[model samples]
Target: MDNYLEDNMAKILLAGESWISTTTEFKGYDSFTSTKLEIGCTELLESLKKLGHLVTHIRAHDVPEDFPWSKEALDEYDVILLSDIGSNSFNLSNHVFSEGRPTTNRLELLKQWVLSGGSLMMAGGYLSFSGFEGKAHYSGTPIEDVLPVLIKPYDDRVEVPQGALPEIAVDSQITNGLGKFPEILGYQTVTPKKDAQILMTVDSSPLLVNRTVGKGRTIAYMTDIAPHWASQDFMAWENYGEFFSRCIKWLNKDLD
Candidate 1:
């Protein structure tokens, strides 16, 4: 591991990035259905783990129930990452949905936590930051206020099947030594906040952005860490692990 990363080990809580799919097959007059579970951040997880960072992943289905609802619970980790997940998971808990009881507003708690010195990051995907059909729906939410970018109203995704290469919009420690970025298939369209720094861009839009919130900081990486958006070239890049490890160090305030 690079000395830069070896000294900045952090406890990271990764939420979302997993999904269940159901498919039905038809043969003549008969039909069969099967369900499969998939996780999208295997490469990212492995990279972080290799750097000696402790990562806890909460799958999409388990987010509503398992996500921390209190500041102390949240403070256990140095950073929290929301990936391919919507606000609904944090909004609608089992108590509210099933028992018709009120629960702690996790989103609001997250906002306060960040302001009080917690680090946060949101990665892009189908269910992330005003995602497909606006289903990810982080727009106008408390989380949106803390993020480095403004989430657009509906369907913020910009699908570029031809591949959109990301460029360093500004020089920063997070991007310093990293060479040219490989092309990404797609990314969300977001506007950088007035005080935020646009570290990376794709198609002239913000791809990686960062800002300080009170005593803490937040990052918005508006592209998937996995395939379909993160191209094979991007994933297979020699500096893939180094790049993300640097991001973690930056988020944890280990990088000056």
Candidate 2:
């Protein structure tokens, strides 16, 4: 095993990325329902782990109850990522929704955490950014203030069945050793902030954007980390592991 020092390893909190889908099949006036649970960020999780990062994943269903609400708990990780999850999952807790009790606003806590030197990243999906039908609802939230892009108030998904190839928009540490990237099937459309660095783009829209918020940093990857949007080809790219691991390293300030 490689003897890596403690500081070389980053503790990462990964919320969302898993979902359950229910489907009904009808045959000759008889219908049956089947439900399946799927995880979208397995590749990303494995990549981070391979690079020696300790990752804590809170699945979509478990996020409402399991996600950290206190600053001390949130400060335990060097970086946090919200992937394929909505703001409601963090804002509406079980107590607040079911019993109408007041709870700590986790979103606001996250914003403050980032401003205090914690890195944060948001990856796109049907339930990320403005998300499908605007249900994700992070447009004007505190999270948006820390992000490097402006979230659309409405649905932001741009479907590209023909595939949209990722292009390096600027020279940055995140894209340093990364060569030609693979084509992605789709991505959320977001505008880069004035002071934000655009590392990559797809279909001329911001794909990877980075910004510094006070003493911390933030990144917005306007595309899925897994399939449907992250095409099979994109996942299988030779530098797939390197590209993602580099992003985490940059966020943690491990890379200069």
Candidate 3:
């Protein structure tokens, strides 16, 4: 582990990774239903926190209102992690979609922020990177231009019930000291863009990719940070915390 990572803290805004679902039950033609709220980034969040980083999570439902819409507001954080959230959340704020009020375009702001030296990372999920049935819909957004990979036009998730292992594609500080990675259950399918550096892969497909945008940096991890994809063994890996910490350092150019 790098001592610098332990001594220095990076402020990170982690958005999404939460959802609500409802189920209905029937008894003698009468129906009852229940709704539950679930979060998916607990392990990742804990891992980053343990590495001495300050992370503030913003749920998907609150993004339209909570996400920073100006460069000044965004300056508070060094990095932004978008996990399991769609463009719509940032594009259609409550003020605009519901109340017909004018609001800043957060996605465009985020793109400019990255161009001006803020780091950004996008982790995979059903609501990430042209996710399930293409509902995530980041295909033509400004964010797409800043990403290191090109998103597919349709649902990009690839399920691996038998588990898939990652293959190192490039030698870099982020990969230093990294041993065998635990198998993952699934990941998104994306093509690395020109000039983008692929750090890792799963069965020949890109698993982690990154690139520089203007003075900043951006990275894409094509798998969930926690279960349904990350698997129990992955979350419990001995180097989980170190791996994420190194990723942050690399994205911030601290390891360069």
Q: How big is the RMSD of model 2?
A: 3.1
Index of the highest-TM-score prediction: 1
lDDT agreement with native, every candidate: 0.90, 0.88, 0.88
Per-residue CA lDDT of model 1 for 121-240, tens digit only, reads 999999999999999989999999899999988999899999988999988998887889999999999988899999988888888999998999999999999998999999999888
Query: How do all the candidates rank in terms of TM-score, highest first?
Result: 1, 2, 3
Candidate 2 per-residue lDDT over residues 78-154, each given as its tens digit? 89989989999988888899989999999999999999999999999998999999999999999999999999999
Residue 66 accuracy (lDDT) in model 3: 87
Task: Residues 142-188, candidate 3: write the lDDT tens digits.
Answer: 89989999999899999999999998998878877789999999999
TM-score of each: 0.95, 0.94, 0.93
Candidate 3 global CA lDDT score: 0.88
Candidate 3: where is the Cα deviation over 4 Å?
Answer: 1-7, 27-31
TM-score of 1: 0.95
| RMSD per model, one decimal | 3.3, 3.1, 3.6
